[model samples]
Target: MRRRRLRALLGAALTAAIAVPLVAVAGDASAATNSFRGVNWADARDNYVNGWVIPSGLTAADSYSTVYTKANGIIAGFQSLLGANTVRLPINPQSVNDTWWASYKGAFDSALAHGMKVIVSYWEADTAKDGYVDDPAAWNTMWDRVTTDYAGNANVYFEPMNEPFGYSLSAWVSLCSTWLSRHANIPRGRVLISGTGYNDNVTGVGAASALSGTLLSLHFYGFWASDTTRAAWTTNLSNRLGSYSSRTVIDEAGSPMTTGLTYTGAANQDGNVFTSYFAATTDLTRARQMGIVYWPGLRTGDTYSITRQSGSGLAVNNASGVAQLRWGWGL
Candidate 1:
């Protein structure tokens, strides 16, 4: 009788072990299917060829001022032409003390007005005493304020920091985790963690996994000086990051080095090099990993501005560049 009872107990334990795995597998499959459900621009036709740059200013009323209206119009025009659904705006944490919020608020409002998604970046400053890196408490406060102001708004994404290279990988991971934990009240899928490398390549999957539900962001600007370098970088990145297979986005990328000059002369040639590099990178297999955001749509003093020269009459002559972006890749 004792031997028979032990056998039955062992059999019951074995059955439960098998059942547990089956149930766990089913749950994982279910979760995978729902991973990207309801995320904005997830199924959009175009690969995310979003643009980034500083707005002309934060103040001018729509349709009234030349500078502000033109800045707003340029972005609106791009969305109309390209069906771009996202825009990345870098927010200097130090500038929050001044009218930076007011200046950018209009642009953010305009993006919403035109049905475009907004990704706000918290950038570090060189000399500022109160930037995001300078004060942890202030950073949290700013995040709270922004989220409170724009909470429940559609298609708005938050990036806690922009290219936090000075901090160790572990430190960055910790900082991002803390920020997300503190803002648990914010709507889900609104905050993203961005890293910088050759192409925003994350150093460790462990670090990436720490981000619970936020998007993984990266920046890639292969040698802006030459197309060959750009191509190599793109291929390297694709190979390195292809295996992760997580929800990723190229938050900033472009080839031609922008110097706040006319679109013609040496600048035009450099821009073409960038365009060709983009074309080559998109053709690679890794391009399928996630969305690609082109850099600097209308801002000057950046390498990836796509709009025409600020005061020069020369129209942005890269129609093919724009066309390639619209036709290539999936966001």
Candidate 2:
């Protein structure tokens, strides 16, 4: 997740109203972007680990059955509490290409068993948080195993890498193209190529003929700018997408959910930055008919986490945050 970076607003205010028709255009076999009503299930450690990754609420010593049961409850809470139909999880070389993988599959299997779509994304280890793949050989090997296991599962999606800021725009596109070539058996519709620069922009990747049929990933946050208006926030996100909104998924948009910010009523009039940001994001995503996966749906200690561990189960930390998310999903 691109935590904080303040940049100037792109241009003069664009209209808050998105004039695009809500007609559902089919980009891939999956139908439309709205089909993915999702939330990111991030590790409490922020998914940037030096060793094996374990999502919050799951221990390193848990068995396959234990992982399954635990993941099922969390996934169930996501669905029941937030109307989420998809869960995006993080993976790494250590997490996927080790003995722990046997038990980890249980989490993936349980999500699939619940009829929820799973987006498995790669996160660079913290030892080298430079946004480049740590080791090409190990990276490919990890993907080889991951794609081999889930290539046949229609509900599973693969993201090449998360926020690859280390590569230039051209280099990132080249890397994504290489990934597509390596895993050609996986349908292009099932692959999500992240935008260049912390997954912030998708126009370059979307226009690449080599990545035509693939989906795009975008991450937008309120802290990226000091824009205080709904129109500015909407324009900020729209500028990053360009003409690829149809194939783009705003998979990592979030703000402070537990800080007692009201998401209801006139958002522009709220005056709080987070309220305006959340309102503009949800409204714009809904207007564009795009998929939105909130960041850190269950990350412990994160104020942005919408849900928290309540005993053995999960409880919502912010009902209004979820309501705004559901509104974006058009639920």
Candidate 3:
């Protein structure tokens, strides 16, 4: 997730960008887009750290074997309780090049072993959280190493970066083009180009023919709007998607699941801020058959977390949230 302060500035840029529409290139999107029924497993400090990142409930002290064991259990909970078939995780240059990667790969291996599609996304470090890549050399090195490691793994997908809000559309597109050309070994279908700003809109990237074969990642939040009805929210989302729904995956859409808000029924959703947003977004996902991944499936201290750690096990924080999520997946 991106910081709200950043959103305040970038949101205006997004509005201006939207004022001038990009022509959507009409083509068939891979059916794989809808096949992802997933959730993000985020770090407690929000995945942007000064050094190595440790996912919530995981310690840097853990060995490879321990990470594998813990990740397996958490993944099992996602499958049995929420019916998730995919998981999105964060990575940074520091985490990838350091020794922690040896142990972190255990989590990916465990998830894949359990038949989960893993999306490993890059997150900028907090020391320079200006929404741009911290270091071009380090960033490219991280991707080179990561792509080399997972080139042969069909279950593992690579997302260039998470919420790249600093670069202009042309500059961001140029970076993505460079990335695609550099790592030609990985299949384009396995690469996800994030939306223009804060991963908020896909129309710009969708129009780029160079990025045609790749999937698009989008993020939405209830706090971004005050639409009272499902229809209004749907319009807001559709405007951003702009004929790219077939190829787009809502990789990060969430609300407060642990706040005792009901997620079912029109009466419960209509006037309420959180419920209305979720209802409209999920309803649209089901309609479009687009892939939708809820934000922070398990993040310590996050009220939006759908699952919580119970002793050594994992449990649902809100049954209704899971129900609505599954409904979006058409489960």
Candidate 4:
């Protein structure tokens, strides 16, 4: 459960470089660039791509290929249905080390082929014994190989791990710093450093000047709060995000999009947590001109998936998620 939330804020980043013309049009602050827009193309039991070894009763030798068709079909919806320019995909360290990445390469290529930037994120090898990304050795090895394969691709981005909240802040940053040193070829701008403590805040991360150039990844969810008022929710997100908006990405902000705009369920039965949080979050991102990625771009079991099965193709799920995201993107 904890692991899934961390990964729910999975890998995603496609920062659009801002090039404001010398002459700025009057009253155009909101027209400023929407840094990056994306979603987490999740992998669960049937579509788990972080498996170090192929699970039993599975058909493919590589992890991602097991769900290739579904992944490809979903990536197809990035442009028209979701109006997103980036996609975040979960990856296993062992798969990259053991050569599954060679076969699994197509899953990423499918997105890049469509001109969609791919943010390759590392989920824990075993969330049970090891926490989300516990083994430094395996992680180092995985990134070494993965970076070598994608060092030159401008469309590909790398995130060390989804959320390293378990480790001390210093230790987590140290690990990331080491990763930066080891993989110098992967541009710092292309790397994403997850904030501490379930990635709820990036203040500390933003202060780490040694880790400059890399983008910050933050996750906001209703479970973290009971306050549904727009002011409270907006303040919480803005305060936690601090001054990182210029280079930060809210890679995961999702609720029961399956239900309509009004949410009434276990997580939000007492309050309109879904609607308020989504609205405030969208407002904050839009105000700051940042970017966001919805959780579970198109995965089973997660209603936050803004994707659905179309006529032999994929489409955004019928819900307020699409509108909320589009609102933030100014689309």
Candidate 5:
């Protein structure tokens, strides 16, 4: 299913490009940061691709080894294509289980070894399980373990949850508050909470006043799946969050669809999508948005994977045209 979805999106992208030439105009290089600009390591249209595990046919050690190789390769490729400085690593607590500490420790070590900043996202049970009613005790316990183990590690950032889909505003506030309270022991200013799904705009940030010591995180993909409902949501979010001085970042963004429905060109309609997102960042430049992490950096046959159509493996392909845009935008 993942593979098929990627193929369809890639087809659409190719069809759109046929009618319009994809050009990446160079932006101001001065905007780059030590993480992205000065060091030329801005945020990336990062692939949520994991390499800590491989297929069943491989031995456990071999699996880790092979996955790490591919993972590092992908990171290098993205840095080259988007001039990105960081990669968001999704860590499933379930996968760690009884060996949670050991698994994550190893994963973090590997990420640091690759010279990439690690954004660790905690995985919770689905909404059907309990909505946002996560066991606060369990969550705190896990964080304690991580902080104690990785104290003073500059390359690590914690994402309390991913998307928080199906969760209400109050539920989100509660979870975020609990997570922030638990971070007293961890290094301050290294944790971030991912915004609500399909509506990462300001309205989605409900408890901005309550959250402390963590940067506000949100995702963007307005061009591909969002509609008027999402637009209104983002507008409300912008208005509500505009007054607050809290730092904000779009940890994730970019369109992975190949449907030819862009904001420019004949079929293009999502052109303003990226520019609008960038405009939102202008207000809080030092807020350190990091950069936009593009999904599916490889054009694999998945809805979110960035694998390409010509079997070009896991590297970013210019054939997508979006890659060029990312580079030009300094993402």
Candidate 6:
């Protein structure tokens, strides 16, 4: 087994320079025009056990081609069931090399054809350095190729990297700066920046001038949270995500869907913790007219995935989970 499970944790391009608190990015008109209900398409090259073990039976032949082909149906389900307009996919460094870019474009094309905005981020499942931006050369190469591929596609968004916890806050922001200047051809509004730390908080980056103009992204899981009350959830939101909701998106928020997603005051594997958290988050996103994307739209052993399917066809697994997503998305 590749132990891909260990790394289980873990937008935009376009036009003008828009001003945000400490950051002023050009062409970030998204602050006024962006709003979406989205989901993450898990299982990129990041592996587990031996090689890449996705929902083992979710596709035919288990090849990269199959994976991308299947993604079409998976994404369609998200649109039909959750009313999702966005789908974030993680790409491994290898996938972006010249050898694989063409293959990966299938998933990208499938998403865009459905009118789904695509947000792609690079991740090193087995990084030599856990918290630092590992494999700088590979990371840059991946972004360079991907940015070039979708440079002007409004539906495609570029997220330089995901969960950049290895670098210090200052170091990370510096990296963001370098990324902006290096890929200047891509507009600021089309990009998305991970917050400080494991993307658990965004207050610092959201306030940094260098990071302005781009949208902000954050991740949430039950393990990352302790607060089970709505009030606490609200306070936490106000502190971490409140400042930039207009240009922020919760690209990864989730909980176990095995129990079927019903949430009530009474505690259950499907209740209290995740329910309260999403409740507050949904309320905030709606109030601020922000974007929201749930984590693991589909992943094996990850109870958080909202859709349950086998071999890439439409086999809806968790109506409870989907229902909550609908509620969160205001469907």
RMSD of 2: 5.3
lDDT tens string, model 5, 231-280?
Answer: 44345335424432244445544443444323222133223554333233
1-331 per-residue lDDT for model 2 (tens digits): 3232221122111112212222333343234598889989888777888788888899899999999999989999998999899999989999989988999998899999999999999988877877789998999999999999999999999999987777766677778889999899999999999887678777667777778789999888887677777888888888888888889898888888888877867833247678888889989889988999998789888899989988777999888888888898998
lDDT leader: 3
What would you estimate as the lDDT of candidate 6? 0.66
User: Quick one: ranking by TM-score, best first?
Assistant: 3, 2, 6, 4, 1, 5
Task: For candidate 1, report its TM-score.
Answer: 0.68
- lDDT for every model? 0.48, 0.82, 0.86, 0.67, 0.44, 0.66
On lDDT, who's better, 4 or 6? 4
lDDT of 6 by residue, 79-167 (tens): 87777899887676665664545655667777888899998876655635275555688778878888887898988888877777666
Query: Can you rank all candidates by lDDT, best first?
Result: 3, 2, 4, 6, 1, 5
Count of backbone clashes for each model? Answer: 5, 0, 0, 0, 38, 21
lDDT of 5: 0.44
Pitting candidate 2 against candidate 5, the one with the higher lDDT is: 2
> Lowest summed lDDT over 10 consecutive residues: which window, candidate 5?
37-46
Could you tell which candidate, 3 or 6, scores higher by lDDT? 3
At residue 187, what lDDT does model 6 achieve? Answer: 86
Tens-place lDDT per residue, model 4, 197-218, is: 6666776666676677788888
Output the better candidate (3/5) by lDDT: 3
lDDT by residue for model 3 (198-242), tens: 888888888877787899998888877777888888888898888
lDDT of each residue in 1-331, candidate 1, tens digit only: 1221222223222222221110111111011111111111110111111222234332223232343354466555556545466777665444344444555566667667767777776755434412136567766777777777777785787878765544545556678878877878765466666653222454342235566455666555444234444455456556434433254666655544344332222233234444445655544423453555666554443334455444422135355555555543342
lDDT of 2: 0.82
Taking all chains together, each candidate's TM-score versus the true structure is 0.68, 0.91, 0.96, 0.81, 0.61, 0.82
lDDT of 3: 0.86
Stretch of 10 with least lDDT, candidate 3: 15-24
Instruction: Give candidate 2's TM-score.
Output: 0.91
For model 6, the run of ten residues with the poorest summed lDDT: 11-20
